[model samples]
Target: MEMPKEFESFAEARKNNFLNVKAAKDAGKKVVGTYCTYTPWEIIDAAGAMPISVCSVSDETVEDAEKHLPKNLCPLIKASYGFAITDKCPFIYFADMIVGETTCDGKKKMYELLGEIKNVHVMQLPHRQNDPVALSLWKGEMIKLKEKLEKDFGVVITEEAIKKSIKVKNEQRNLLKEIYSLSKLDPPPISGYEMHKIFDATNFVVDVEAKNNELREMISGLQEVAATGNSPVSKDSKRILITGCPSGGVAEKVVKTVEEVGGVVVCFENCSGIKEKCVNVDETKDVYDALAEKYLSIPCSVMSPNTGRMELLDELIEEYKVDGVIDITLQACHTYAVESFSVKKVCNENKVGFMNLETNYSSSDVGQVRTRLEAFIEML
Candidate 1:
């Protein structure tokens, strides 16, 4: 399928994040690598440090990681560790420090191992997000993190800098949200894969203003396509909502399979999806507290009483007019695997078709996955 010219720059950026990091480093910019979206990029930006997400979804690094990590561990964690140990990832190599979060047990323990090779700072994310004490603890952690960045980078993170970062980041999020809202149109002007590419590309790019402009242009192009009655998906395509683990690499595979089987992925409620960009920081509040509140609200499976995730899923289902839900849990990702049961229950309560797919990073089961998705689409 032909892509809009406006989106070409974003697509190119996704392929060259490493190169961009190299250029930034050569220019003497300190780069901080992060593993989770919960890591406050605003703080990193304010500290004059480039914050780049270092999560790995490639199967190529898993073999090396298994030498240190258990073979049965989550592939995302294994792949991340493997990339660090093998020096296979440019982003990891360029990073002066890696920010780890307690999002899941596998990741929490894996960071310990990652620390041996990299300067790792682990954030103790609260498991119960709504508890007042948990919020206070998280707020404290954010403050500590801010101080650490200032001391480590030798740059004072003033409130003014943080607020500016917040405004820039919020603008990016709003643009992304606008692009995602286009999916609500009948015969969505863009495919889910295209939307995923846009999101993934934005993550790699450091220039928020440029990215925001590119996104606006892309949205305009999409709107023009919609006005002309052009759609990448057929009007009869089954609308699908995907929720579960991050599914970084697996997202493209699942989306491709679904589309090939006559389904259109209209919404994604995972870490790598629209939900991550849907929330904006309250600029009126204390920057640290606002960051704490915004990140805490993320519906990661690690949090107890994950009602926020369910509520978000329910809202997306109704808003997108979803016909089915596909819960994707990476093998050995126990948090999401266990949460799939509740996700399935929610889908049933809504009278929507649901399927739970458990897999790993390897493409060996592509045929099996495709067949399963085909059957699921048939049922829908």
Candidate 2:
């Protein structure tokens, strides 16, 4: 089959940008949740609940939260808890509860304070993630989340419903995988920025099957405009790889900027990229078993390095013939952020050119960001 399209269009999503916050205001959906890789946001949305992908830095910018939050905390963490600390958190008042997980050091510390916010609930990812202990714990957490959803939104959490939702998520994943595969082709069918719009729009819109259908049409209609001679596809572009956890726009931006500056982003190994994978459920398997499998196999915040995350990235780099690497991490996501120095040093030692760009919210201080990106590109 011809390559399937990436479902979201930059123009369409921009036009409908107001829908997400509007749905929440209309009491149509209860959550604007923050998720790492593979967190069931689609399932939550499928339940007719409004689920906004959480931006960790909004609290500070919107609620004056930076005053109370430790300055060292990642801006996203500060933003998430900004309302609680400063009393201006719109999400705190609007959300039934902010369902959270202790995915990294900054989040873990921030989670403790959320308990004080009255309506917030937190999920502490197990220390031994992906192993038996974590698998069992996550299943229990899903159950608890189901109960919370029902209680908070009055939507019954049925096994059948979750199963249907899983199917939808899988379909979306398949479509995205196809899009990623297209990126890997001899001549990428589109530009890096064009691909980012697709990724971003998927998060905003609904109806997965229809979304994929749209994507298929777009991809089929696409002309194989080779990457700007700057994409990893064009051996001429500076080959670069990026590593980080729980990134969406940030990861995409890293690739976009690199491509913009004659650097080819050969591989992206963030949690949201390839490390966190979703498993298809067998009809014969029990629902719980299927659920466990889904959680256990997901490359999430904790599933780094150990769960083939590190190995998978290593292979992608070698396979893609990456010429350099970029570490995109949040300041508060201590696990990934603190590891930045190591990531850089190792890349240096390995003689792989690399740079680290830290961010709170993906969009912040464009002028400042432009300078840094330009510097990174010049070095290349």
* Best by the lDDT measure: 1
TM-score of each: 0.95, 0.77
The TM-score leader among the candidates is 1
Over the stretch 145-201, how does candidate 1's per-residue lDDT look in tens digits?
888888888888899999999999999999888889989999999998777777877
User: Taking the tens digit of each residue's C-alpha lDDT, what string does model 2 give over 1-380?
Assistant: 11112213223544354444544557555654544543555346545665554444242353365565677766666666664554343334445556677676766666776777656666656656447777788778766766777777777766777677667766776776667556565445655555655665665554566788987777555533443343334545666676775455354455666777776654556654545442454435655566666655655435455444554555666665666787877765666765666566557656777877777553664556667777877776
Check candidate 1 and list the clashing pairs.
Answer: none
lDDT of 2 at 100: 73
Question: On a 0 to 100 scale, what is the lDDT of residue 257 in model 1?
Answer: 78
lDDT by candidate, in order shown: 0.86, 0.59
Q: In model 2, which regions exceed 4 Å deviation?
A: 1-15, 20-32, 42-48, 57-63, 83-94, 112-118, 223-235, 245-256, 277-284, 300-307, 338-352, 358-380
Which residue runs does candidate 1 get wrong by more than 4 Å?
1-15
